[model samples]
Target: MATADGEAPRPEERQIEPLHLPTPEEIRGQDIWNNCAVRSVASGVMGGGLGFFMGMFLGALDNPIMQEEMTTKQQLIFQAKQMGRRSISSAKAFGIMGLIFSAAECVVEKTRAKHDTTNTVVAGCVTGGAISAKGGPKAACVGCAGFAAFSVAIEKFLDRHS
Candidate 1:
């Protein structure tokens, strides 16, 4: 209803019932799941696209003569197929890594009752190492180190900025 001043009553002044909100624990759990799904999908798509372009570029660089021999349309089609293959490989790697990291985070949350940077780094390292294990021991070590470093850097940057 409008007040005498021709303005509606303020929300606080009205007889409004209290709204029920989920508890912090419930919110945290939902947030974790939501973030996991979103981040995993996004990472997969982005990684795939990046890998595709990089592979195409490197392929072209490796055999400039072969690229030059093909017609424009033919080259485009060939590059597209190559890019697609590389993209699929990268997408799978990133997708698996994201799933593993998410699962590890959930486990940590359940056991420790809190999420922290160390847990995130550990999860990343494990995921990266597992993904790279197909390459060799050295590659696995490098992947683990790279992921751990990346996670720590990101966490520190976020903490500093936030």
Candidate 2:
């Protein structure tokens, strides 16, 4: 910028940035969330919160099995119960999923010692297989492939956008 002297300020005379002191919360956040377990738990909680909302929305749109035979009050009660049940179920599922996925990814990244799509895919496969293990071997394999592909696509999309 030009001064009254019609000249730019010299580098030596330029203003320096002021020092910043982090707040307690900021310092605590970094300190407490510096581990894999903490990150996984946080992810689980966030996923559970999102799932709860999604379940509520879906439950609101769902028609009760015997809505035609119920009074207005009864139907409302039924819907409320359904919404609550759905939300709880979804929250649990999502929380477990998030915990599993985040832990797997963290472990995989640490072991591989690399930050790349390969780690994402491996972690995704592990998560998918674990989630689908109850369905049998065939189902697990399918889930592994599907989730790995999904992870790769997501990673690629974020990479391109960022």
Candidate 3:
């Protein structure tokens, strides 16, 4: 059908934005970041950094055990060492915790096919149980229950705030 002097379809005549093709580099970058392993690792690293800072702050607040006997320089050195040790130890724990929680959440989300609090609770249980398994079955059960509860509370708080 022809319009008043129109040979083209109205859809075609309407303005259309030009398609933007992502470059090969952009495609590869997206693929790399979208990978599950990369995402877990990134989360672990970020968690570790947060834990490190927290540990440092807490360690700095600690009073030297022998402050009365130690010279000023000795006290400084002792505090520095304490901070470093605390930071590294907490960082390791936080990194593992983050990685496990992230991976578990991803798997739970994928398996359940939903994005909701149940996934968070399951992931928290898995992570906590796995982390505490070394303490024995009872500890693992306790950890799972406690973490699941904590996860639920956090989920509710976030949902309410959001």
Q: Which candidate ranks first by TM-score, i.e. highest?
A: 2
* Cα-based TM-score, every candidate: 0.60, 0.80, 0.78
Q: What TM-score does candidate 2 get on C-alpha atoms?
A: 0.80
36-142 per-residue lDDT for model 3 (tens digits): 68888998999899889988988888888779999999999988988998899889889998999888887787788878888888989998899899999999999
Off by over 4 Å in 3: 1-33, 160-162
Question: Is 1 or 3 the stronger prediction by TM-score?
Answer: 3
1 or 3, which is superior by lDDT?
Answer: 3
Q: Write the per-residue lDDT of candidate 2 for residues 25-100, one digit (tens) a residue.
A: 9999987775789989999999899889988987777787888898999989888988898888899888888888
- State which candidate, 2 or 3, has the greater lDDT: 3
Query: Where's the lowest-lDDT run of ten residues in candidate 3?
Result: 1-10
**CA shift of 92, model 3, Å:** 0.5
By lDDT, rank the candidates, best first. 3, 2, 1
**What residue pairs are clashing in model 2?**
none
Lowest lDDT block of 10, candidate 2 = 153-162
Q: How big is the positional error of residue 8 in model 3, measured in Å on the Cα after superposition? A: 37
List ranges where model 1 is wrong by over 4 Å. 1-19, 23-65, 135-138, 160-162
